[model samples]
Target: MCRWLAYSGTPILLDELLYKTEHSLIDQSMHSKLGVETTNGDGVGVGWYEAGEQPVPALFRGIGPAWGDVNLRELARVTRSGLFLAHIRASTGTPVQQTNCHPFRYGRWLWCHNGAIHEFRELRRDLMMAIDPDLFPSISGSTDSEVMFYLALTFGLREEPVRAVERMAGFVEQVAKAHGVAEPMQMTVGTTDGDRVWAFRYSSVGKSRTLFYSTELNALRTMHPELEVLRGLSEETRLIVSEPLGELKGAWQPVPESSYGVIQKGADELGSFTPR
Candidate 1:
C-alpha cells in the first residue's frame, strides 16, 4: 500500500504538489487517511519529464522517508515538470531499498503503482521467469511493485500501454488462482510518455485502490479566485492523486473503479476495462 500522485499539464515546480497543499504528499507521508497504513515511511520516489526535451523521463528515488528527506525538500523547491509521478511507500514483504521505490522508468515511459500482489513470495519466481531476460536484469529491486512494471513491459507497454496493463493484470490473476490464492490484485497505476498521461484505478474484486484526478482549470479558477498558483497553471493542466491534496471540496474527482483515464496534451479521455 502507498500514497502516490501523477501530474500532467503545464510545467510547474514540484513543490506546488509535493509541499504546498494543506494535506500534500509530504503531509500524507506522515498522516495519510486513505492508505492501508497511516504513515508510509518505507521509502519515497519522484519521476518527471523535462520540458522541451526528449520524451524519456528522469527519476529521483531514496530509501529515506519523504517527510524527513532534506534532498527532497531542496529538489521540490527547484524542479519543475509538466508530467510527474511521486510516491510514498509502505512495504508489505519486500525490504526497503532504493530500487524498490516507485516511478520506474524504461525508455520514454514513466510508471508508478499503489497496491500489492497477493502472496508475492509464492508467485515471485513464476512471474520473474515470464519477463523477457533482456529487461529482467534491469529490475534492480525485489519488490513485487517493480516486477509489475517489467511485466507490463513484457506484455507490450511500450507499444500499447492500456492493453499491456490489462494483460499484465490478467497474468497475475491467472497465476494467483492456480495457486489457490483467491484474493484479487489491486492496482492504481499512472504512466506517461511525455505527450499523454494515463491513470488507472482498478482491482480484480471491482473495489479497487483509492485514486483521484482534478477537474477542469476554468471551473477551479471560477470557484477559488484568490489562489495565486492557479494563475500560473494552464487551462489544460491536470493532476491525479491517490488522495485529495487539499481541503478544496470539488477540486478532486474520484476515478471510477475498473476505469483507465487518459490525459493527452490537448484532450482528456477515459475508457473502461474488466480486470480478469
Candidate 2:
C-alpha cells in the first residue's frame, strides 16, 4: 500500500537517495512499479539521526504528495545523515493526515511499514487492547502501521527486535482468528534505534509485499567500478527498500519470503522468520 526505504552507511545527502537515482523515492512516489498502488501521494515523512547527536531521530512530515513539496525538496538537498528512513504513503482505508504517515517515532526508535492488517476494521479494537496500557496513551495516530509499532514496543522491541516482532505478529494472528478473519497480517517493516536496522517481510498466508536490500558495498563497487560514489561510501553502508533505487546489475537482492534480516557493522545476517 506504500513504499519506503531505510539507509545505513556513510553519511550522505538525503537527495542522493530521495531524488538522484533512476527510480528514487521521489520517482517512486509518482510511479512505483512494485507497489500495489502506482502513486503513493497520501503523505510523506523522513526521519534521520545526526552523528554524535542523541540516538533519537529528527523528523519532517507533511500530509501532501511528496513530489509537489518545495519544503521536502529543500530539506532533501541539504540534510545529510548516516542513517535515515523515508516513506511515501498511499492510504489503505485510513484518513490521509500527517499523524497517519509512516516512520513513526518513539524515543530513539523509528519504524515504518508498507503493508496492513487484513480486515483491520474487524481487528483494530482487539489489537489496540493488546498494547501495554502505558504505551497505549502515546499512540497518536489511527493507522494500523502505527499501532503495529506500539505492539512491537510492548513486546520488547528495545532489547530483542526479532523476537519482539514475532510476538506482535503472533498476537495479531491470535486476535484475528478469534474474530474469524482467515488472514490476519501482511507486512514489510523496517525499524532502527540509530545503530542497526532490522527489516522483516512476512504475511499469514505466505505472499507478502516486495522488499530488497542492497548487496555488500564492496561487491557493488567491484561490479560497477565506474560509479565513483559507491567507492566513497563506507563498506558498512547498506540500504533496504521496497524496490531498487537504480537498475545497476547485482545492486539489489530480494529479502527472502517469511524472513527477516539485520543490517549492522559486520556481516549482515538473514534468518528465517515466522509469526510465532
Candidate 3:
C-alpha cells in the first residue's frame, strides 16, 4: 500500500502539510508506521487547485521517492492551494514509472488510492472492459488505482462521487467473483474536483487500511491555543490522510471501516458506506 494526504482548507503553502508535520507524508515514505510497506519510494505525485482559477487541478509527479525529490521540495515550498492531494506510491505489482503515479486526473477531478485490488491480474481485464469506451482511451497506466479512478468516472463520479465509488467497489466484487477471487478489494481513497473532497475506506473483509481526518480547525485551535497557524485557518479547514500526520491529541480521528465522508467549504458530512 501507499501513503497519501488530502488538504481542503486555507490557501497555505504546500510544505505546511507535506513537510512540516511530525510524521509528514515525506517522512512516511521512509518510515511508515501503519502501511503494509515501510518504504513507498516507487513514485510520488501532487495535484492542487488554484483558487479563483479553472476547476481543473494541476499535477506534478515523478518516478522518485518524495523524500529525495528536489523539485517536489521547491514546489511544496512555494505553491499554495486551498485544495490539494499528495501521494507516495508503493506499487503492488506495477512498474515504477511516472505514468503509474497517484493523483490521476480526469478533467476537473483528481484521485489517489492507498490500497490494492487483491490479485489484480485476475480482475484487470474484466474491470477494464467495464469502463466506458470514451473514458477507456484516457487510461495511461497499468495500476489498479488508475483503473478504479476511471471506473468511478464511468459510474458517474462527476455527478455523484460517493455513489459512484460505492458502485465501483460493487462492480469490482462482481467481476472478481466471476473470476474465482473471493477477497477482491481493499481501498482508502481520496478524490476531489477542485472544490469538494471525498474519501472512502473499505475492504472485502472489513479490515481496511488506516485512514484519518483532522479535527475541525476551530476545535483544534481551541485545544492548542498557542498554535498560531491553527488559529489562522478557516473553520472549514480539513485534512484526510492514510495516517495521522502527528500525535496531536484530539486532532485526528480514525475514519470508521466501511465508511466515507465529504470535505468541503462548509458542508462536511460523514456517513456509513458499503459496496453498492
Candidate 4:
C-alpha cells in the first residue's frame, strides 16, 4: 500500500501539507501509522495545476525515498498550487522506478491510488487488453495504479469521474473473478481535473485501507480560532489524505467505507458508492 493526499482551495506552498504538519506526508513516508507498511520509500511524486489557464498539471516524480529527496523538498518549498496531489509509493510488486510512481497524468487530469489489484499478474493481460487502444500507448509505467488510471479514462473519467471509477472497479473485479481471484480489489483513489477533486474508498473484501478528509474550514476555524493556519484558509479549502496530518481536535473525519466524495468550488458532496 501507499500514503497519499489531495488538496484543494487556497493556494499555498506545497510544503504546508508535505512538511509543516504534525504528521505530514513526508513523515508518513517514514513512520506511517495507518498504512500496511511503515515505510513507503519506493518512490515519490507530486502533481499540481498552476494558477491560471493551464490545462494540465505539472509533475515531479523520483524513484527515491521522499524523506531524503532534497530535490523534492526544494521544489515543495517553492511551488504553490490551489489544487495538487502528492504520493509516496511502496511498491506492491512492481519495480521501483520513476515511471511507476503515483500521480499519473493524462491531458487535464491527474490521479493517484493507494491500493492494489489482487493477483495483478494473473489479471494483467486481460486488464491491459480492456483499455482503449488509443489510450494503451500512454501507459508509461507497469504498476496496477497506472493501468487503473487508463482504465478509468477508457470508461469515460473526463465526463463522469465517480461513475468511471465505479466502472473501472467493476471491470477489474469482473476480470479477476474470471481468473479465480477471490478478493480482486483494494483501493482509496483520488483524481482531479484542475477544477474539482473526487476521492473513493472501496475494496472487494469490504475492508479497505484508511482514508480521511479534513473537517470543513469554517468549522475548524470556529473550533480553533487561536490557530493562525486556520485563519489563512478559505471556506472552500479541503484536504483528503490516507491519514490525519495532525492531531488537531475535530480536524479530521473518516471517509465512510465503500463511499466517495467530491470537492468543488461550491458546496462539497459526500455520497454512497456502488460499483457497476
Give the per-residue lDDT of model 3 (tens digit) for 1-276: 799999988899999889999999999999999999999999999999998888778999999988999999999999999899999999898999989998999999999999999899878988999999999999999999999999999999999899999999999999988888997899999999887899999999889999999998777877899888786788888999999999988999999989999997666999888788
TM-score for each of the candidates:
0.96, 0.99, 0.98, 0.99
TM-score, cand. 1 vs. native: 0.96
Q: What TM-score number comes out for model 4?
A: 0.99
Flag clash pairs in model 2: 9-237
Candidate 4 lDDT score at position 128:
96
Stretches off by above 4 angstroms in model 1 are none
Error of 1 at 43 (Å): 0.7
Model 4 error, position 186 (Å): 0.1
The digit string of per-residue lDDT tens for model 2 on 189-266 reads 999999999999999989999999999988888888899888788999999999999888999999999999999988
The C-alpha stretches of model 4 lying farther than 4 A from their native spots are none
Model 3: ten consecutive residues of lowest lDDT = 227-236
CA lDDT, every model vs. true structure: 0.88, 0.94, 0.93, 0.95
Which residue pairs of candidate 3 clash? none
Flag the better candidate by TM-score, 1 or 3.
Answer: 3
Cα displacement (Å) at residue 148, model 3: 0.5
Q: How many residue pairs clash in each candidate?
A: 0, 1, 0, 0
Error of 2 at 155 (Å): 0.5
